[model samples]
Target: MANIKSAKKRILVNRTKAERNKAIKSGVKTAVKKVNAAIEANDKAAAASALVAATTTIDKAASKGVYHKNTASRKVSRLAQAVNKMA
Candidate 1:
């Protein structure tokens, strides 16, 4: 409902970006969940592998500006710690 042409374009662009960000965040959440499930199952090997994939997904998300770098780092660190502690 933006009357100005530029404002309408901005609204469209923002909506598209919001959808993309939502998808990226959802993927990150799923990746993290996979890692957590592996850890809870006490499968060391699975957890280790899942952590690597999750870390990669998280890093990509951060690079895409979906997440802040330090926030992503903290997430990876916590997941890695849980996996390592299983040993």
Candidate 2:
């Protein structure tokens, strides 16, 4: 649909970025789910480990612009609090 060369290039680039963002978001969701599942199981040790992995994944996603820094921080904080409360 893009007739201009530059526009065509931009379309391709945008498509690639969209795919990358989608993958990152999916990974973040999976990480968060793992933490939640561990918490629900009442396994403090598992929850703690999951939290660490989730935190790292979230921070990386934020750094890569997949998520806002404050949003990522808030998620990490909530997950940490849940894990702490389980102890």
Candidate 3:
């Protein structure tokens, strides 16, 4: 429990930010799963489309500070590699 007024406000703000970050992370996971699912199904077209969506979501998450830029780039690269390997 925060006693001071400012501290209490900070707690509330932190909670809100945490929830927002959690949602962004969840979305990123879902997008990545979609890409993986398409890849597993051996559907090149679907996988390509899913990769696009995943890349966009990952880039956005990185820009928003939910993920580090290099980390996001690595993820995108790996997913792209997997999709390319399907060929």
Candidate 4:
């Protein structure tokens, strides 16, 4: 599909980057879900731990450009709020 050599190289590079980004996004989603599940189960300690993990993952994703900085901050803030409310 890519005719030019440069285009072909770009395609390869993009594919690699896409896979990496997908993994990071998946990690972020999983962490967030874990936090939400803990919160729903009324396990404050678990929720707090999950919140820390999720926030760390989200910050990492944002720093790596997998997510927008403001979006990551908002998510972390909301998650923290939810966890805090569990007490």
Candidate 5:
């Protein structure tokens, strides 16, 4: 649909970026789920470990621009709180 060469290149670049962002987003969700699962199972040790992993993943995602900084901080904070409550 892009007749201009620059427009076509931009479209291609955007598609690649979208795919990468999608993968990062999926990873973020998986990490969060791991933490939640650990919490629900009442495994304090596992939850703490998962929380650490989730926080790292979220921080990376935010740094990569897949998630907003505030959103990532909020998620990490809530996950940490949940893990703490299990203690």
Candidate 6:
């Protein structure tokens, strides 16, 4: 428990931000998993489409501060590479 009023407000604000971050992370993970599943199934078309969606999701997460821009770019790059390698 935080004694100071400001401390209590900070705790609440922090919790809210954490939840938002968690949701964004979850969406990103789900998007990545979808791409992986498509790759594993050897569905090239599906994988390509999934990669686009995943890239968008990852970029949004990075823009929202859930991930660094370079980190997001790397993730998108790897996924795109895997999809391209399938070609």
Per-residue alpha-carbon lDDT of candidate 1 for residues 1-59, written as tens digits (9 for 90 to 100): 78999999999999999999999999999999999999999999999999999999999
Residue lDDT tens for model 2, 4-70: 9999999999999999999999999999999999999998999989999999999999999999999
Prediction 2 TM-score vs. true: 0.96
**TM-score of structure candidate 1:** 0.98
User: After superposition, which runs of candidate 3 have C-alpha atoms over 4 Å from their true positions?
Assistant: none
C-alpha TM-score for every candidate: 0.98, 0.96, 0.97, 0.96, 0.96, 0.97
lDDT of 3 by residue, 6-62 (tens): 999999999999999999999999999999999999999999999999999999999
| Model 2 residue 27 CA deviation in Å | 0.6
**Which run of 10 residues does model 5 get worst, by summed lDDT?**
78-87
- Model 5: residues with Cα > 4 Å off, grouped in runs: none
Query: Which lDDT values do the candidates have, in the order given?
Result: 0.96, 0.95, 0.96, 0.95, 0.95, 0.96
What TM value does model 4 have? 0.96
Residue-by-residue lDDT tens digits, candidate 4, 36-61: 99999999989988898999999999
lDDT of 2: 0.95
Model 4, position 54, has a per-residue lDDT of 96
Q: Count backbone overlaps in model 5.
A: 0
Q: Where's the lowest-lDDT run of ten residues in candidate 1? A: 78-87
